[model samples]
Target: MKDLRLIFRYSKPYLRDLIIAVGLLIIECAFEMIIPVLMSTLIDEGVPAHDMPVILRQGGLMVVCAVLALVTGLLYARFAARYANGFAAELRLAEYAAVQKFDFANLDHFSTASLVTRMTTDATVLLNAVNTGLRPLVRSPVMLFMGLGMAFILSPRLTIIFLVATPILAAMLAWIVSKVAPLYGRQQSAVDHLNSRIQEGLTAIRVIKAFVRGDWENQQFDEVNTELSDASTETFRFAVLNMPSFQTVMYTCIVCIMWFGGNFILTGNMSVGQLTAFLSYVLQVLNSVMMFSGVFLQMTRSLASARRIREVLTEQPDLANADQPVTEIENGAIDFENVSFKYNAGAEKNALSDITLHIPAGATVGIIGGTGSAKTTLVQLIPRLYDATAGTVRVGGRDVRDYDLAALRDAVGIVLQKNLLFSGTIRDNLKWGSPDATDDQIWAACRAARADEFLDRMPDGLDTDLGQGGVNVSGGQKQRLCIARTLLKHPKVLIFDDSTSAVDTATESGIRHALAQLTDVTKLIIAQRISSVQSADLIVILDDGRLHAVGTHAELLAHDTIYQEIYQSQKKGGDPQ
Candidate 1:
C-alpha cells in the first residue's frame, strides 16, 4: 500500500484526468448494464404478442444505449491514456533527477546496471499496469454488485449459484497471487542480473576481444539469460492460472443457471425474457470477477516494480549544502586536518587514516602513492564527491562543507584516470568544461595540453567526430583531449589523477611546462612515474593511505628510503610500470 501511495503521489498532476476517466468508465458500464434489460423487454412483450411497435421501440432504445456505451468508452480511453503516459513520463524524470542528486556514498548502495533497470524496465511495467488496470480497477466491483443486484431481482434462488462459484474462483486467485507475488520480485532481479552482464560485456568489448574471451563472455551471458527466462516462465505460469480457474468456475455457474433456470420458466415462476436476462447478468458477474483477477495479477507485478522505483525516489543524498552556505572560493589553498575516511560506516578500517597535510594557494604539489593508498580518494574530497568520515577538510581557508556544492566544484577541476569522452565532435569534447568558450580559447587550451599535436593532422580538426567514448582517438590523444577539456574550466585548483600516463615522458614534460605558466592555479599531480612529478615545488609521498614523506625531488632522494627506491626503479625501467 505504501508503494501504491508513492505511485499515486507521482501521478498527482494527472489525477484530474484519471478521475475523469474513472467517471466515464462508470457511465459506459451503466449504459452496458441497461442494454440487457432492454433486450429482455423486447423478447418478453414484443416477441410473445407479435407487437411490432414494442419490438421496434425496445430495439431502438438498445441501439441508443450501445452508442452511448461506445462514446463514453472512447472518452474513457482518451483520458486514461493521457493520465497513464503522463504519469510514466513524470515518474521517470523524478527517478533520473533523484539519481543525479545522489552523492558517491549514496550511489554505493546501488549499481549502474541496477539503476538502469529500475528507471527503465521497472517504470515500464508500472506504465503498462496502470494503462491496462484502470478500467478493471474502477469497473470490476461496480459491475459485480450491479450485476448481482439485477440477478437477485430476476430470480433470487438462481442467484445463489454465483455465491458458490465466486468463492471457489476467489480462493484459487488468492492462492495464485500468494505464489506469484514473490516470484515477480525474483523475476525482476533476474532481469537486473541479465542487464548487468549485457552492459559490462558491451562496455568492455574491446578488452574481451583482445583477450579472445568471446566463448567465456557468451557462457556468462547465457547463464543470466537462462535465469531470466526461467524466472519469467515460472512467474507467468502461476499468473496465467487465473484465467483457467476463472473459466472453469464461470462455465460451471452458467451450466447450473441454465439447468435450474429452465425449470423456473417451465413452472411459470419466470418468463423466457427473465431467464435470459438472468443468464446475461450471470456472465456480467463472473466476467467482472475475471477482470478483477486480471488486475490482481498486474498489480502484483507492478507492486514489485513500485518498491524498486521508490527506493531510488526516496533516497537521501549523503551530502547537501549547509543551511547558510559560503558560495565563494577565496583561493586554491587546501588543508586536511586530522582527517579520516571510511567508504562504509561499518567498515573494518578507514581507507585513509588520521593524517594532516596542507598545500598553499598557487602551489604545484606532486602526490606519489602505492596502489590502494587513496590518492584519488584524497582529491575527490575537494569537490565533496565523498564526505570525510571524520575530521574536516578545508579549501580556501574554510571548511569544504561550508561552501555551496556548485561553487566548490566549479572552483576545482579534476581530470579522472579514465579519459572518457562522449560521442561528439572533437570541439564538443574540448569545450565541455566551458560550453561558451571561443574557438581561439579552445585552441589555446589544446596547445597547453599538447592535444593540438594530433588535431593538426586530422582532416576535420576541431570538427572531427570522436565516436563513442572517443574510441576514434588513441589512448594518448584521449588523455590529452581530456586534459584540454579540464584546462578550459580555468579552475583555481586542478587535480590530475595519473591522467598523463598514456603519453611519453617528453610530451608529458611539455604538458607540465604549459601548466607551469598558470601562476594563479594550484596543481596537484598524482603519478606512478617519478619523472612526472619530479619538478614540483613540493612532493608528497603516500604509503598505505598515510602521509609517508613531503619534500622536493632532491630532498626526498637524499633522505627518504621509499622515494630513493622509487627513483632507482623508474631509472632502471625508463618509467615505473
Candidate 2:
C-alpha cells in the first residue's frame, strides 16, 4: 500500500475523468437495481390482473432503464480507459527520467533486464489493475449493500440466508489473497530472470554462433522459461480460487432461501412476485461479492509490480552539483591527492588505492597498467563519472567536487574503454559531442581522428547510417568515430582509455601527432602497447592498484623493471603494422 502512493500521484492530473467515470458508474447501478422492482410489480399485479396497459407500461420502462444503463456504462468505460492509459504513460516516463538522473553508483543496484521489466512489464501490470478494477472496485460494495437492502424488504427471512453466507465468502477471499501475495512476488522475479536470459542470448547471438554454443544458450534459456511458467501457474491458480469459493456459498444460500420462501408463500406470508424478486436480489448481491473478490486478487498482483516500480522512483542519486559550484575551469592541470576508491560500500579491497599525482597544464602523460589495475577507474574520477571513495580530485587547481557537474564534464572529455554509438546516421552520432557544432568543425575533428580515411571512400560520407552500436562499421572505424566525437567537444582535458586499441600503430601515431598540436590542452592516454604512449612527456606505470613508477619513456626503460618487461614483450609481439 505504501508503494502504491506514486500511482495515485500520477493519477492526479486525470482526476476529472476518474470522477466522471465513478459518477456514471453510480447512475448505471441505480438503473440496474430499479429493474428488479419493475419485474416484481408486473408479475404481482399486472400479469395476474390480465391488464395489458400495466404489462406494456412496465415493459417500456424496463427497456428505457436498460438503454440508459448501457449508454452510461459505455461512457464510463471510455473515461476509465483514458484515465488509466494517461496515468500509465506518465508512470513509465517518470521511471525513465528517474534513471537518467541516477548516478553511476545507483546503477549497481539494478540490472538491465530488471530495469526494462520495471518500466515495461511491471508498469503494464499496474495499468491492467486500473483497467480491470476501475468500475468493479466501486460497484461491488455499492451493488452488494443496495441489493441486500432490497432483498430484506421482499422477505427478511430470505435475507438472513445472505447474512450467514457473506462472512464465509469474505474469509475465503482473505485466505486466497494471503496465499497468493507472495507467489505474485515470485512470479515477477521469474519474469526478470527470463528477460535476463533472453536479453543475454540475443545481445550475444553473434558470439554464440561464432563459438558454436547455440545448444548451451538454448539450455540456459529453457531453465528460466520453465521457472517462469511454474511460477505463473502457481500464482494464477490461487488467484482464481475465489470464483469456486463464491459459487459454493452462493448455491447453498439459494437453496436455503427457496426452502424457507416456499414455506412463507404457502402460509400467505409472501407473494409469488416478492419471492421471485427476492431471489434476483440475492444473486446480484452474491455476484457483487464475487466481483469484489476478483478485484482484490488482481490488486494483490498489481501491488507486487507497484513495489518494483517504487524501487526505481525512490532511489536518490548519489551524484549532484554543489549548492554554489565553480562554473569555469582555470586550465587543463589535474591533481589527485591521496585518492582511494572501492566499487561498493562493503567492498573489501579498494579498486584504486591512495595515490597522489600531478600533471602540468599542457603536458601529455601516458598510463600503463596490468589487468585489474584500475586504469579506467582513475580516468573516470576526472570527469566525475564516479566519485572517488576518498580524497580530492582537482581539475584546473579547483576541487572536482566544487565544480558544477555539467561544467566539469564539459571541460573533461573521455573516450571510454568500451566505445558505443547509438543507432543513427554518422552525423547524428557525432553531434552528441557538440549539438550545435558546424560541419567544418566536425570535418576537422574527423581528420584529427583519421575517421576521414573511411568517410572519404563511402558515398554517404557523414550521412551514412551506423546501425546499432555502430555495427555497420568495423571495430577500427567505430573507435575512430568515437574519438572524433570526443574531439568535437573541444575539451580542456582529454583522457583516452585505450580508445585506439582497434586501430593500427601507424594510424594511432597519426592521431597522437594531431593531439600534440593542441598545445594548451592536457592529454592522458592509457594503452597496452608501449609504442602508443612512449613519446609522452611522462609515463606512469601501475602495479596492482598503486603507481609503480613515473618517468620519461627512455628513463622508464632503463630504471623500471615492470615498464621494461612490458616494452620487451610488446617489441617481441611487434606492432600491428
Candidate 3:
C-alpha cells in the first residue's frame, strides 16, 4: 500500500480520466442490477396475467439499458486503459531519472538485478492494480451494497437467511488472506533472487565456461528455480481455495432462500413477484461478492509488490549534491589534509588513511602502491566520489563540498581502472566526454592518446558500434579509446588509474609519450608498472592506506624503502623492454 502511495502521487495529475471511468462504471452496474429485476417482473407479473404488452415493454426497456451500459462501459474501459498505461510510462521515466542521480555509494546498496526488478516487475504490478483494482474494489463494493439493500427491500424476511451466511464466509476469507499475505511477499523476493542469479550467470557465461563450471551453474540455477516454484505454489494453493469456499457458501445460502421463501409464498406472506425479485437480487449480490473474492486475492500480491517498491522510493540518497554549493573552481589545485576514509564507518581498517598531499596547478604527479594501497580511493576524493572521514579535501583552495558537484567534476577527467563502455558507436562514447567537440578535436584527442591507429583501421572509424560494456573491443583497445574520450573533454586535471595496464609495453610507452606532450593539463597517473610513473615530476608511494613516501623517481629510490623494493622487482622483471 505504501508503494501504491508513491505511484498514486505520480498518477494524481491524470484524475479526470479516472473520474469519468468511475462515472461510467456506476451506470454500467446500475443497468446490470436493473436487468435482473426486469426478468423477475416479466416472469411473475406479465406471464401470470398473460399480458403480452407488459412483457414487450419491459423487455424493450431492458435491451435499451443493456445497450447504453455496454457502449459506455467500452468507452470507459478504453479511456482507463490508455490513461493507466500512460501514467505507468511516466512513472517509469521518473524512476529512471531518480536512478541516474544515485552515486556509486548508492548503487552499491542495491544489486543490478533487484533494480531491474523494481523498474519493471514491481512497476507493472502497481500499474495493473491501478487499472483493474479500482473497478473491482471500488465499483463492485457499491454494487454489492446496493444489491443487498434492494434484496432486503424486496423481502426482508427472506434476506435474513442470505445475510446469515455472509459473515461466516467473510471470516474464512480473511483468515486465508492473512495466511497468504506473507507468502506473496516471500514469493516476490524469491523471484527477484532467481532473476539475479540467472542474470549473473548469463552476463558471466564466458567465465563459467572457461572454468568448466557449466554443470555446477546449472545445479545452482535449479536450486533457485525450485525455491521460486515452491513459493509460488504456496501462494497459489491459498488463492485456489477461495473459489470453492465461496461457491459452497453461496449455494448453501441459495438453498436456504428457496426452502424458506417457497414456504412464505405458499403461506401468503409474500407475493410471487416479490419472492422472485428477492431471489434475483440475492444472486446478483452473490456474484458480485464472488468477483471481489478473486480481486482481493490479486490485491494481496499487489500489496506485497507495492511494499517492495516503497523500500526503494523511500531510500534517502546518501550522495546528494551539497546544498547552495558555489558555481565553479576558485583555484586550479587540490589538497588532501590528513584524510582517512573507511568504506564502512567504524570499521577496524581504513581503505585510505593519514593521506596528506598537495597537487599544485600544471603539475604531473604519479601515485604508486601495491594492490591494497588505496591509490584509487585517494584520487576518488578529488572528484568527491566519497567524502573523507577525519579530514578535508579541498579543490581550488576550498573544500570540494563547497564547489558544485558538476563544477568540481567538470574540472577533473578520470579514466578509471575498470574501463566502462556503453552500447553505442565509438563516436557516441567519445562525445560523452565532450558533446560539442568537432571532428578535428576528436582526432587530436585520439592522436594524443595513441588510440587513432586502431580506431582508423576499423571500417566505420569512429562510427563503429561498441557492444555493451565495450564487449566488441579488446581490453587494450577499450582503455586507449576511453583515454581518447577523456582527452577530448580537456579537463584541468586528469587521473588515469592504471588506464594503460592492459596495453603492451611499447604501446604504453607511446601513450605516455603523448601524455607528456599535453604540458598544460595537470596529470595524476596511478599505476603498478614502474615505467609508467618514472617520468612524472613527483611520485607518491602508499602502503596499507598510509603514505609511505613522496618524491621524484630518483629521490624515491634513494629515500623510500617500499618504492626501492618495487623498483627492484620491476627491474628484475626487466621493465617489459
Candidate 4:
C-alpha cells in the first residue's frame, strides 16, 4: 500500500477526471441494483394480480434505469481511460527525466534494459490495472452495502447468511493475496530479465552473426523465455484458484437460501415478492464480492509495478548542481590536484590514484597508457562525468562543482572511443553539437575532421541518412563524422579518447594537423599509438593507474625508461617491453 501511494501521486493532476469517473460509476451501480428489485416486482406482484397497467409501468421504469446505467457506465469508461492513460504518460515522462539526471555512477546502478522495462512494461501494467480496477473499486463497496441493506429489509434471516459467509470469504481472499503478491514481483523480474536478453541480442546481432553464435544465442533466449513462462504460469495458477473458491461459496449460499426461503414462503412466513427480492439482493452482494476478487488480482500485479516505479522516482542522482553555480567558463585550462577516483567506493584499488597534472589554456597534451591505465577516466573528470572521490578537479580555474553542469559540459567537447550516431541525416547528426550551426560552419568542421572528403564522394553528401547507430558508414568514417560533430561546438577544450583509432595513420595525421590550427582551443589526445601524440607539447605516461612520467616526446625518450621502451618498440615494429 505504501508503494501504491507513489502511483496515486502521479494521478493528482487528473483528479477532476478521477472524481467524475468514480461518481458516474456509483450512479451506474445504483441503477444496476434497481433492475433486480424491479424484476422481482414484475414477477410477484404484476403477474399475480393480473395488473396490466402495473406491469407496463414497472417494465418502462426498468428500461429507463437500464438506459441510464448504460449511459453513465459509458461516461465512466471514458473518464477512466483518460485518467489512466494520462497518469501513465506522466509517470513515463517523469521516469525518463529522472534517468536523464543520473550521473555515470547512478546509471551503473541500474542496467539500461531494466530501466526500459520500468518505463514501458511496468508502466503499461499499472495503466491496465488502473483502467480495469477503477470502476469495480468504486462500485463494489456501494453495491455490497446497498444490496445488504435491501436484503435485510426483505428478510433479516436470509441476510444472516451473508454475515456468516463474509468472514470466511475474506479470509480466503487474504490468503490468496498473500501468496500471489510475492509471485507477481518475481514475474516482473523475469520480464526484466527477458527484455534484457532481447535488447542485448538485438544490439549485438552483427557480432553474434560474425562469431557464428546464432545457435548459442537462440538457446540463451530459450532459457530466459522458459523462465518467464514458468513464472507467469506459476503466478496465474495461484490466481485462478480464487474464482473457483469464490463461485463455490457463492453457489452454496444460493442453494441454502432457496431451500430455506421456499419453506418460509410455503409456511406463509414470507411473501413470494419478498423472497424474490431477497434472492436478487443476495446475488448482488455475492457478485460484488466476486468483482472485488478481480480487483484484488489486478492490484496485486500493479503493486509490483508500483514498487519498481517508486524506486526510480525516489532515487536522488549522485551528481547535482551547486547552489551558486558559475554559468561561464573563462578558459580551457584544467587542473587535477592529487585526484583519486574509484568506480565503486568499496573497490580495493582506485581507477586513478593521486593524479596531478595541469594543462594551459591553449597547450596540446598527449596521454599514453596501457589498456587498464585509466586514460579515459582522467579526461572524463574535466567535464565532471564522474567526480573525484578524494581531491579536486578544476576547469577554467574554478572547481567543476561550482559551474552549472550544462555550461561546464558545453565548454568541453569529447569524442569517445565507441562513436555513436543516431538515425538521421549526416547534417542532422552534426547539428546536435550546435543546433543552429550554418551550412558553412558544418562544412568547415567536417573539413577539419577529414570527414568532408568522404561526404563529397557520397551521393547525397550531408543529406544522406545514417541508419541506426550509423551502421551505413564504415568504422573510420563514423569516428571522423563524430569528430566533425564535436568540432561544430567550437568548445574551449576538445578531447579525443582514442576516437581516431579506426582511421589509417595518414588520415589520422591529417586530422591532427588540422586540429593544430585551432591554436586557442586546448587539446587532449589519448591514444595507444606513440606516433599519435609524439608531437604534443607534453606527453603524460601512465602505468597501473598512476602517473609514471610527464614530458615532451624527445624529453621522455631521453629520460624515461617506460617512454623510451614504447618509442623504440614502435620504431622497431615490435610490441612494447
Candidate 5:
C-alpha cells in the first residue's frame, strides 16, 4: 500500500470526477438494494393482499428507481472511463520524460522492452484497476453494511446467524490475498522478461536468420512465454479459490436464515413481509460480497503494477544539477584534468585512467588507438555523457558539468561511430542539426562533407525519402550525411568518431581537405586509418586507455615505436599513398 501512495498523487487532479463517480455509485447501489426489497414487498404484501392501488404505486416507484440507477451508473461509467484514459496518457508522458532525463549510463541499465512495459502495460493495469475497481470497492462495502442493518432491523436472531459466517469467510479471503499478492508480483515480472525476449528477437531477426537460428530463437521465446503462462495460472488458481469458498459460506448462511425466519413467520413472532424482506437483504449482502471478491483480485494486480511503476519513478538520475547550478559555456577547447572513469564502480580497472590532455581552440587533433584503448571514452568525457570518477572534464574552459546538458552538447557536435539517419526526407534528417537553416546553408554544409555529389544524383535530392537508419543509402553516403548534418550546426568544437571509415580513400581525402578549411572551430578526429592522422596538427596515440605518444607525424615517426610499425605497414600496403 505504501508503494502505491504515489498513485493517489497523480490521481488527485481528478477529485471532482472521482467524487461524481462515487456519488453515482452510491445511488446505483441504493437502487439495486431497493429492487430486492420491492420484490419482497410485492410478494408478501401488495400481491397477497389483493390491493391494486398498492401494487400499482410500488411498481411505479420501482420503475423510477431503476431508471435513475441505470442513468447514474451509465454516467459514472462514462466519466470514469474517460478520466482514467486521460490519466494514463499523462502518466505515460511523465514516465517518458523521466526516462529521457537519465544519462546514457543509467538508461543502459534497463532494456527498451522493460521501459516500454513500465510506460504502457504497467500504467494500463493500474488505470483499469482505478476505474473498474472504484465502483465495486466503494459501492459493495456500503451495500453490505446497509443490507446487514436492514436485516437486523427486521430480525436480530437471523442477522446473528449470517454474521457468524462472515469472520470465517473473511479469514479465508485474507489467506488467499496474502498467497496471491506475491504471485501477482511474480507474474508481472515474468511478463517483463517475456516482453524483453520478444523485443530482442524482433530487433535481431536479421542476425537470427543469418545464423540460421530461427528454431533456436523460437524455443527461447517459448521458454519465456511458458514461464509467464505458469506464473499467471498460479496466481489465477489462488484468486479463484476465494469465489467458491465464499459462495459455500453464503449458501450456509442462506439456509440458516430460511430455517429461523420461516419458523418465526409461522409462529406469528414476525410478519410474512418482514421475513421476505430479511431473506432478500441476506441475498443482497451476499451479492455485494461477491462483487468485492472481484475488486480484491483487481486490487492485487494493480498493486503489483504500481510497485513496478514506482521502481522506475523512484530511480535517481545519473546526472543532476548542483545546489546552485551554473548555466554557461565560456570556451570551446576541452581539457581532461587527471580524469579517471570506470563504467561501473567496483569494476576491475578504469576505462580511462588519470588521463590529462588539452586542445586549444581552432586546432585539429587526431586520436589514434587500438580497439578498447578508451579513445571513445575520452572523447565522451568532453560532452559529459558520463562524469569522471575522480577528476574534472572542462569544456569551453569551464568544468563541463557547469554547463547545462543542452548548452554543452550544442557547443560540441559529435558524429557518433554508428551514424543513424531517421526515416524521413533527406532535408528533414539534415535539418535536425540546424532546424532554422536556409536551403543555401543546407547545400553548403552538404558540400563541405562531400555529400552534395550524391545528393544531386538522387531523384528528389533533399526531399528523397530515406529508409530506416538510411539503409537505402550506401554506408559511405550515410556517414557523409551524418558529417554534413553535424557541420550545419556550426558548433565551436566538432568530433568525428571514426565517422569516415565507410568512405574510400579518395573521398576520405576530400573530407580531410574540407576540414582543413575550417577557420575557427576546434576539431577532434578519432580514426583507425593512419592516413587520417598523418597531417593533423597533433596526433595522440593511445594504448590500453593510456597515452603512449603525442606528436606531429614527423615527430612521431622519429620517436614513437608503435607509430613506426603503423607507418611501415601502411607504406608497404601503399594504401594511404
Candidate 6:
C-alpha cells in the first residue's frame, strides 16, 4: 500500500488526463448497458406482434448506442495512452534526477546494475501496467455490478447463479495472485544479476581475451540466463491457471441459468426475450470477472517494480550543503585536526586515524605511503568527498563542512589514480574543467602536462575522437590528458594521487617543473618513488593508517627509518618493502 501511494503521487501531475479518460469510459459503459435492454424490447413486442414500426424503432436505437459506445471507447483509449506515456516520462526523469544527487556513501548502498534496472526495466513494467489498468480497471467493476442488477430485474431466480459463482472465481484469482507476486520480485532481481555480469564482462573484455577465458565467461553467463528463464516460467505457470479456472466457473453458471431459466419461461413467469436478455447480462458479468483477473495479474508485477523505484526515490543523500554556506574559498591552505575516518561505520578498523597536519597557502607537500596507508583517503577529505569520522578538515581557513559543496569542489582540483575520458573529441573532454575555456587555454594546459607531444602527431590534433575511455590512446597519453584537463580548471589547490605512475621519469619531471611555475597554487602529490617527492618543501611519511614522519626529504632520509628504507630500496632498483 505504501509503495502504491508513491506511484499515485507521481501520477498526480497528469490528473486532468486521468479524469477525462475515466469519464469517457463511464459513458461508454452506460451506452453498452442500454443495448441489451433495447434488444429485449424488440424481441418481446415487435417480433411476436409482427409490428415493423416497433422493430425498426428499437433496432435503430441499438445501432445508435453501439456507435456512440465505439466513439467514446476510442477517445478513452487516446486519453489513457497520453496519461500513461506522460506519467512514465516524468517518473523516469524524477528517478534519474534523484540518482544524480547521491553521494559516494549513497552510491555504495545500491549496486550500479540494480539502479539501472529500476530506471529501465522496472519503469517499463509500470508503464504497461498503468496503460492496461486505466481502461479495464475502471470499466470492469462498473460493468459487473450493472450487469448483475439488470439480470436481477429480468428474473431474480436466474440471478442466484451469479451470486454463487462470483465468490468462487474471486477466491481462485486471489490464490493465483498470492502464488505469483513474490516470483515477479525474484525475477527482477535475476535480471539485475544478469545485467551486472554482462557489464563486468564488457568493461574487462580486454583482460578476459588476453587470458583466453571466453569459454569460462560464456558458461557463467549461461548459468544466470537459465536462472532468469526458469523464474519467468514459474511465474507464468501460476498466472496461466487464472483463465481456465474462471472459464470453468463462468460455464457452470451459464448451465445453471439455462436449466432453471427454461422452467421460468415455461410457467409463463418470463418471456423468451427476457430469458435471452438475462443470459446476455450473465455473460457480461462473468466476462467482467475474467477481465478483472487479468488486471490483477499485471498489478502483481507492477507492485514489485513500484517498491524498487520507491527505494531510490526515498533515499537521502549522505552529503548536502550547509544551511548558511561560505560561497568562496579564501586561499589554498588546508588543515586537518585530529582527523580520523572509516569507509563503513561498523567496520573494525579506521582507514585513517588521528592525523593532525597543515600545509601553508601555496606550499608544495609530498605524501609517500605504503598500500592501505590512506594516502588517497586523506586527500579526499580536503574536498569533503568523505567527511572525517572523528575531527575536522579545514580548507582555506574554514571548516570544509561550512562551505557550499560546489564552491569547495571548484577550489580543489584532483587528477585521480584511475583517470577516465568520455566518448567525444579531445577538446570536448578538456572542457569539463572549464566549460568556457578558449582553445588557447586548452593548448597551454596541454603543453604544461606534456600531452601535446602525441597530439602534434595525430591528424585531427585537438579535434580527434577519444573513443570510449580513451581506448585509442596509450596509457601514458591518457594520464597526461587527464592532468591537462585538471590544469585547465586553474584551481587554487591541486592534488595528484599517483597520477604520473604510467609516464616515463623524464616526462614526469617535465610535468612537475611546469606545475612549479604556478607559484600561487598549492600542490600535494602522492607517490611511491622517493625521487618524485625529494624536492618538495615538505614530505610526509605514512605507515598503515598513521602518519609516521613529516619533514623535508633530506631530514626524513636522516631521521625516519621507514623513509630511509623506501629511499634506499628505490635507489637500488628494487620494489619498496
What is the number of backbone collisions in each predicted candidate, taken in the order shown? 0, 0, 0, 0, 1, 0
Best by lDDT: 1
- Candidate 3 accuracy as lDDT: 0.84
Worst 10 residues of 2 by lDDT: 568-577
**Cα lDDT of model 1 by residue, 425-540, tens digit:** 99998878899999999999999999999999998999999898888999999999999999999999999999999998888999999999998999999999898898898999
Query: Candidate 1 overall Cα lDDT vs. reference?
Result: 0.92
- Alpha carbon lDDT at 312, candidate 5: 77
What digit string (tens of lDDT, one per residue) describes model 6 on residues 57-87? 9999999999999999999999999899888
lDDT of 3 by residue, 90-191 (tens): 777777877777777777778888888878887898788778877776666877788888887778878787668889878878988998999988888888
Superposed Cα RMSD, model 3? 1.8
Candidate number with the higher lDDT (2 or 5): 2
Model 4 ranges with Cα > 4 A deviation: 574-577
lDDT of 5: 0.86
Model 6 spans with C-alpha error above 4 angstroms = 49-53, 574-577
Candidate 5 residue lDDT tens string, 110-170: 8788888989889989888877788778877888888988888878888898678888878
How far off is residue 402 in model 4, in Å? Answer: 1.0
Writing each residue's lDDT as its tens digit, candidate 4 over 140-247 gives: 899899999888878888888899899989989998999899999999999889999999999999999999999999999999999999999999998998999999
Better of 2 and 6 by TM-score: 2
lDDT of 6: 0.91
Q: Alpha-carbon error at 128 in model 2, in Å?
A: 0.4
What is the TM-score of candidate 5?
0.94
Question: Taking the tens digit of each residue's C-alpha lDDT, what string does model 2 give over 391-462?
Answer: 989999999999999999999989988889999899999999999989999999999999999999877999
Q: Quote the lDDT for 525 in model 1.
A: 99
Per-candidate TM equals 0.97, 0.97, 0.96, 0.97, 0.94, 0.95
lDDT (CA) per prediction: 0.92, 0.91, 0.84, 0.91, 0.86, 0.91
Q: Which residue pairs overlap in candidate 4's backbone?
A: none
